[model samples]
Target: MKKIVIAPDKFKGSLSGIEFCNAVERGIKKQIENVTIVKLPLADGGDGTVDALKFYTGGKLIAAAVHDPLLRPIQARYLYAENEMLAFIEMAEASGVRLLKNNELNPLETSTYGTGELILDAINRGAKHILLGIGGSATNDAGMGMACALGFRFFDAENNLLEGRGKDLNRLTTIDTSMVNTELRNIKFEVACDVDNPLFGPKGAAPVYAPQKGATKRVVEELDAGLRNFNEKVETQFGKNLQNIAGAGAAGGLGAGCVLFLNAELKSGTELIKSIANFDEQVKDADWIVTGEGKFDEQTFSGKVIKGVLDSRTNQQLAVFCGLSELTAEQIAAHKIDYLAEIIQQASGVEDSIKNAGKYLEEAAAQFAANGIVSK
Candidate 1:
């Protein structure tokens, strides 16, 4: 029997990684008999990281009361594995830009306090190890809001207590950790980060990502200045130069905050997830490996699940399935993609493709199996 591994990331707004795997498996089984299929759903420590890890570890999702980016009360969930004392916290659960309306996407006014609440909740419940996925953040406060939620207090030069927000960063003079949870010191935090942007510079978080979160050019400059101020304060107190750390600008400087405050280690999201899933051992002997994402572009080769899969494959023929392909023919050839399946080809348009992604994916997988898979 031919062994096939179906490893795919979540198709944002359409299907979960596991759902994608199921759809592909159903389609492939219909076209091939006498084949063993392994469904290995994957994530890059972003939106669906918790779900993917939960599926692998049989963990439970725990909901907690938390604040949103705007400091509004909301409920967010994280994956908790009791036996392992591990918690997978996707920062976007509370501070994600998707939670706000387009008109409400103001990075300067946003806060990551909600994300801190999730972390504290996990820690209170005996989570000794935290895998934090810091992506899709809405705030540009350098994690001041998150740190505040964990009992850190910010003060201005006048000794006025300040609320942690992007607008408050420029006024930050001191950080008080007197009330911080003592348990936090004993916990281990591993941040899943992919980008290499520094905390403060032309390519920093504010200038590069704040505009996407609805920042005007002026607001972007202000946010960048605030980040620099925050970094200066951190350097004065902690003696760590956060501005130069690669990936320090991720999630609106939450990456740097996790490192300095939580003593977290930053790691490639894809590689971290792959290690947890034992990806290499599982696919080392497979005859074919099928991988996919919502959009196949330059980012797909940069610390994404598809990239991790490609790097791990020894002799397996690779087939890529995506909602849309942005790669040039030369890029495809360079990556050695044996078979390319696009769900868009099986649908009417982008909207129709998204609305009926499972159906389209099934059809695409079926087409690949019938035409791309060769008899051994």
Candidate 2:
């Protein structure tokens, strides 16, 4: 009996990580009998982290009342693991760009208030460790809402409480940490992030990502100015300049916010997932390994799940690898992946490719299992 591990990240709009594993399993079983398949979902601290953790922790999903990026009331779900007293949070659930209509993409007016509400709920539920995945954020409020929820007061130059939006960050002049949730002081916060852009500058939050969230030239400029002001104010209050910190601009500056305000430790999402998932132990005796994501471009080599999988394999001498949708021959060759295939190549059109992604994946897995001979 061959032991195979199928670990894959969510295929974005097409398939979830679990779904991908199932598809792969179906394919493998068709080609080989009595094959042991281990499914481990993966995420890069972005949209699918909570779901991935749910598989590893057997956590319960809890729904909470929160606000959207525009401060609209909404309900979002997060995961809680009673055994570990851990809460898994995906920032996208509360402030993702997907929540807004195409015409309503205004980064300046958006806020991360709902994300804060989720965190508060986790704390209230007696969670001692928070696994915060910061990705796909619709707001660039530098974590003001989260800070507010934890008892930090943001004030304007006139000494009035600042209202909302990243634009209001410019007016922020004071931060009162006295009311900060005492529970947070004793809790562990592990922030899963990947980007290294600073909080404010040419390559910072506003200029680089705010436009994608619906900022125009005018709004980007204003938001940039506002973020600069907020950074200066934060420096005055905390004696630290977060403007140039790597990963500070992740999740519309949520990375900086968590670090400066909540004392959260920032780490690569891939590393965090590997540790929490115990991927090494899972793959220790596996005969073959499969890993991929939506797109396997040059980016996959840099801090993505594929790289984590490769790194976790202690005995690199073993023939271990997987397949992906969009990988160049050269890129695949560089990784030394044992079996390489794609679903899009076999589909008729874009819609069909997406719709039949699972089927295609299954077919690819079957073919690989039949012909993917690994030499030790």
Candidate 3:
């Protein structure tokens, strides 16, 4: 192929996507000689969203002082494209579950208020459209904490203002939008989400996700009840029923909250990334498309980067590579993945594979080009 498109996700504990691209490109260049290589590193609306978009738009990283999930002050960042007036905010940066320690992770007491602060900062910087990546959150307050940062006051039956937490939901009687930052209404919010869970049922936010964030069964029930109360209160106050919205459970009900309060549009993470990347324009005349991840197991069949890339483009000329893959031959045949390479298979052992991921990636790319023996 005269032109090749190399797009990949991060290797988890090893290299970032861009690092993979560079290593692969160097390797490919060693064999391909004169091919054109287009590098596009992708993310699934989670940890790597900012860097992915930054690569796409050449956006500047804007840092703001915000609170972590535990309400501690910290500096977090988002991608800002000044010319496009788009602010890319990953909620995880400000209130991600990873920010908490094992002993500190408590869904009952966490908050998304920091995310709200980031949004406010973006607005102050003249961002007209906000692209919020809602993933890896530490709170289950149904976005109440975020709303608080935007000046939406929550009150108990006694009309007493309440500090936000998952446990605070049961005490909330009504919301005060009269004090909400009116500026939020003018900003268009597009949320990047991948889950389809509802707000408060069996497959809803708390029951499905709270335990992973360190909630006990009792806390899970409490958070679920809190979401129901918040949902009912929202419907009563705003004439909007958000209980059944697909993706309502993403990031601890931040999806539902943004839709209900910020009038945000929810989109699959891949779809949103594709729009910003505009890969169609970049791949129109490409002779080959390469994509991969750390693991290509059954989960890869879902909506992760490799699947996203395959779905986004035809597979006739697509080449697949991964650190480790467990796809059956039938599955590989079904996806029409003709050119495939596994880096782990080329290593001495699993530990050696991960430790020398970049070396193996470069070698794999070169082997795919020079030898054409990827064992597809």
Candidate 4:
């Protein structure tokens, strides 16, 4: 039997990676007989990381009570593999920007304290290896909120305690880490960080990402100053200079904080997730490989699932099924894509494609199998 590997990322607001795989599998089965299909739903260390890992690895999903970005009570989940004593956490589960409304988008007030609680929960459950996906954050606290949850305390110039918000960064005068959860020192922490922005400066967290998290032009300047001040304080207290580090600005400076507080290493989110999924080994001998994202555009090559699949290809035939294709034929040819299909082209319009994405996707897959695969 021929082997087909279906690996895809989520279509953003539409279908999930797993749903994409299922729809493609169903379509493939309808057109092809005596074929083995391997479904590997993947994520790039963002909102769907835990769900993808859990679906692909059959890991246990563990939920805990935690605070949202606004410090409101909520339940969040992480993926745990007991035998490996590994916990995979998507920080967005607790402190994602999507959790807040347009009016509530103040980065100065948002907190990653909830994310820290999830990490602590995993630690308490005996996680020896913790993979933290620190993407889509709503805060600009420089991971101060997270550290506080792990028992780090911040003090102001007047010796007043701080709550670790973006507003507290400039006021930060000292850090107390003596009470941090001792277990954190024993466990290995690997942070999924793909960006290369430094902790503070023109391309840093505040200038580039603060606006998305609800900062105004004036507030952006304030956050930038705060990040700079916090970096100096961190270097003085921890003897680590995080401002110059690559990926230090990721997750509103949580990347730098992970390094300073948990001694964590920052890694490429796409590469890290692929390594965890054993993606290369799974697709090595496959006869056909299928992958995609929401839009087949330049961003698809930016450490996304399709890029991982294309980079790992050998002699296997590849097909891409996306919601829309923005890549010109020349670009597609440059990337060496064997075939491409867009659901928007198959449906009545963009709205119809999104409304019945799975249906159109299934039809596209079946047609691909019949015309593209069978014709070969």
Over the full model, what C-alpha lDDT does candidate 4 score relative to the true structure? 0.90
Q: Which residue pairs in candidate 2 have backbone atoms (N, alpha carbon, C) closer than 3 angstroms, thus clashing? A: 196-247
C-alpha TM-scores of all predictions: 0.91, 0.90, 0.94, 0.93
Q: Residue 35 lDDT in model 3?
A: 78
Ranking 1 against 4 by lDDT, winner: 1
Residue lDDT tens for model 4, 1-376? 7899999988888898899999999998899988999998888888667768777567799999999999999999889988788899888889999898999999989889999999999999989999999888999999999999999999999999999889999899999877888898899999998899999999999999999999999999999999999989878877788987999999899999999988999987777778887989999999899998888899889878788888889999999999999999999999989989999998889888998999999999999999988888
Instruction: Please tell me which predicted candidate would have the highest TM-score against the true structure.
Output: 3
Candidate 3 wrongly placed segments (more than 4 Å):
373-376
How accurate locally, in lDDT, is each candidate? 0.91, 0.83, 0.87, 0.90
Score residue 35 of candidate 4 by CA lDDT: 91
lDDT for each residue of candidate 1 in 1-376, tens digit (9 for 90 to 100): 7899998899999999999999998888889987899988899888778778988888899999999999999999999999989999988999999899999999889999999999999999999999999989998999999999999999999999888989999999999989998999999999999999999789999999999999999999999999999999999998999987899999999989999889999998888888888999999889899999999999888899899899899889999989999999999999999999888988889999999999988988888888887443
Worst 10 residues of 3 by lDDT: 367-376
Worst 10 residues of 4 by lDDT: 47-56
Top candidate, metric lDDT: 1
Candidate 3 matches the true fold with a TM-score of 0.94
**What is the lDDT, from 0 to 100, of the residue 328 in candidate 4?**
94
